[model samples]
Target: MTATVPTSALNLVGKVFKPSELRFPAMPPLGLYIHLPWCVRKCPYCDFNSHLAPDSPLREVGTASVIPLKDARNPRDEAPLTHALPVDLQRRYLDALIADLDQQLPKVWGRKLHSVFIGGGTPSLFEPALIDELLGAVRARLGMPMSGEITMEANPGTFELARFEGYRQAGVSRLSIGVQSFSDSHLASLGRVHGGEQARAAVAAAVQLFDEVNLDLMYGLPGQGVEDALADVNMALGLGTTHLSLYQLTMEPNTLFAAHPPELPDDEVLSDIEDAVHARVAQAGFERYEVSAFCKPGHRCQHNLNYWGFGDYLGIGAGAHAKISYPNRIERETRHRNPQAYMDEMLAQARPAEVRSLTVQELPFEFMLNALRLIDGVPDAYFVERCGRPLSDLQGALKAALDKGLLDPKPGVLKATPLGLRFLNDLQSLFL
Candidate 1:
């Protein structure tokens, strides 16, 4: 038996909400990204926002000389073999990072951090105590969950057992070792400061220290053959790393590699390397969850997953970029690219270097660009939830993709088919 509501109560309950009164859907899980912009030396084939360590002895060396002098550190020096991370500069930067977070906190007030990624040029170069202090500051301000994943990107040349142990003690649950290649020739060709031996040592230390470790490897490198590429994968597998980020070397504009391109493997060899990497990692019980990302079961990178899922993240550091969601709109923000400028701006409490809201017409492509990268595409509901629109809005593009056999024909899932995954760019272009 149901009791009938009064007409007046029913009228109030069924009242239509005005467009302005309706609130946007709740935001996705949030993460934080802290970028350290200085590396011992910048790689020629790299175009990330990394720069050489300031005041290093090799600062004036020609780009071509970077590789040869990579291992020229004085053996007698008891200090860490890499370029020194100035204590004062580190303090200033950490303070600036805290201030930056303070400015961004209101946007995510009361939200717990899902994960944190401390990435960049060579985060391992900083002292472990400093890393601890940085993390402490973040935890104090942001309120990270006890079980949240905190990852720090480390380079082989700066590997130190004590340093790594200290990082583990300082609450870094994961370590991403930049072991680009285990082949000495390939490492040199890529302008890496560490050789095969140092890379191996770094991985060994990371595996022993952290429960979750990711080995970053690049194939199709200059003069690399299928055998060389396979060897790298095999060696990384042998190191017991739980995850791998395998990338193909590309020459981007404004990079030294673009100005004077190295002799890369031909198209055929490049294809072979890709094929071999896929087969080997799969055979070793790893799943290619996303493009360029392979991982053992339960070991996927949460911070990266947040990005691919179009979740909100606050990036606080030099040259860091962020995408945030609000009740009415979504916007992106970026910090100053120059380290000093970023610090100065943060100290001055200035607005972010840039901020822009995404127009409705632009949301679909931007959302798909990230979501479709995953082998298992995002849920259909996310299309409407994250993009602030109905799925019908994408009917034309979806129909075209299905007609071309690029999208799965499932009723409620938005995933690419095998053919679509192979021609990912073309498939994604349909959204635009």
Candidate 2:
């Protein structure tokens, strides 16, 4: 629990009060992130704050059925998942969601949102009617502008044409389906509920119902080859999706895969696979706009763009995080991680959590983390506007980066060089 620095020392509302104090730059565009924290089953490689649904089978402990991680079976051979939360339970969760938003409204009062994204453990598991009610409730509470983009993350295992249509009618303009791979063995290796055929069918159906659809795919699996990665990318491109998110599977800390340790591809094989996949997607007319995202012209995901641009967002739900700005500082907020506990606290009208304003010393590294990931990078002026510091402040670090050829020498832009994008970790670390 870090404390927010006192704002009394800064009299200037829209400018930096001193060299040591943070500036109050003009507010950046704001977005909304709504989290639904239940999934069908937790994947071995996934470290997201997801939990098993209540309706899922549980191991008995002293006459009580519990959903614990100690079931001790092979994660890759998990039982077939059930994709429904009872209707009554959905209603309860929805109630807590609205209350959560109501309490956070004052923090972002009257700000026009640039976009809204409903992400999850598995948002599609709840029925479409629940989604409709949730979105409708948001609109009723806020003065959101009539913007076109409202994205929802859905799982392919629960794909249904009618459900998609219902979502479209409910105003979800974009759909991002979690189709990790289009091969049956690869899908099982990732502990996915949907098979290859189901993934293809779902993408096909979704493209027909919605004009904009995105597919999520992974590379560098336990035994995947370059050809296998290419096959998955080709299948996604052929499915008429507007965007593709190709991520290399990495074993994050605290995940089952990290502890059990799958035999992942070596660095050499992974490099070859990534090069082939990148070249193939570019040839098919998808621009690699960000590190892991590709899309056709004019179909960028607005919600994610806000994130990478270091813009403001209000996050509400279990285990969700948000970054908001005020007259003199930026604040970060997080909610309770457990779904049941989050619901109980919110429904009781309890205050969610306190946030510490980002200090001046931590601003540069924080801004670079998101801004440098863009292929084109951010403009030099954007640094002054968003980060509230003149380019002169980074004179030493910028010169070192240019001397090492890690950043472009082009004036007015702060882009990473080709080599910098390759070793992005080393490049971003310079700011720290």
Best by the lDDT measure: 1
- lDDT by residue (1-432, candidate 1, tens digit) is 011223332233323434333224556678999998888767777778886776444432245432553443323444454546677888898889989989998999878788999999788877888899989988898877434799999988788788899999999999999888998777877777678887898899899989999999999887788888999999999989999999999889988888888778899889999999999999999999898999998899988988887778999888999998887888899999999999999999998999998877777788889988988887766665665555555779999999999998987567889999999999999999
Alpha-carbon runs more than 4 Å astray in model 1: 1-23, 59-66, 69-83
Best by TM-score: 1
Please list the residue runs of candidate 2 whose C-alpha ends up more than 4 Å from where it truly belongs after superposition.
Answer: 1-17, 57-83, 144-147
Clashing residue pair totals per candidate (backbone < 3 A): 0, 0
TM-score, candidate 2, is: 0.89
TM-score of model 1 vs. true structure: 0.92
The lowest-lDDT stretch of 10 consecutive residues in candidate 2 is 1-10
Clash list (residue pairs), candidate 2: none
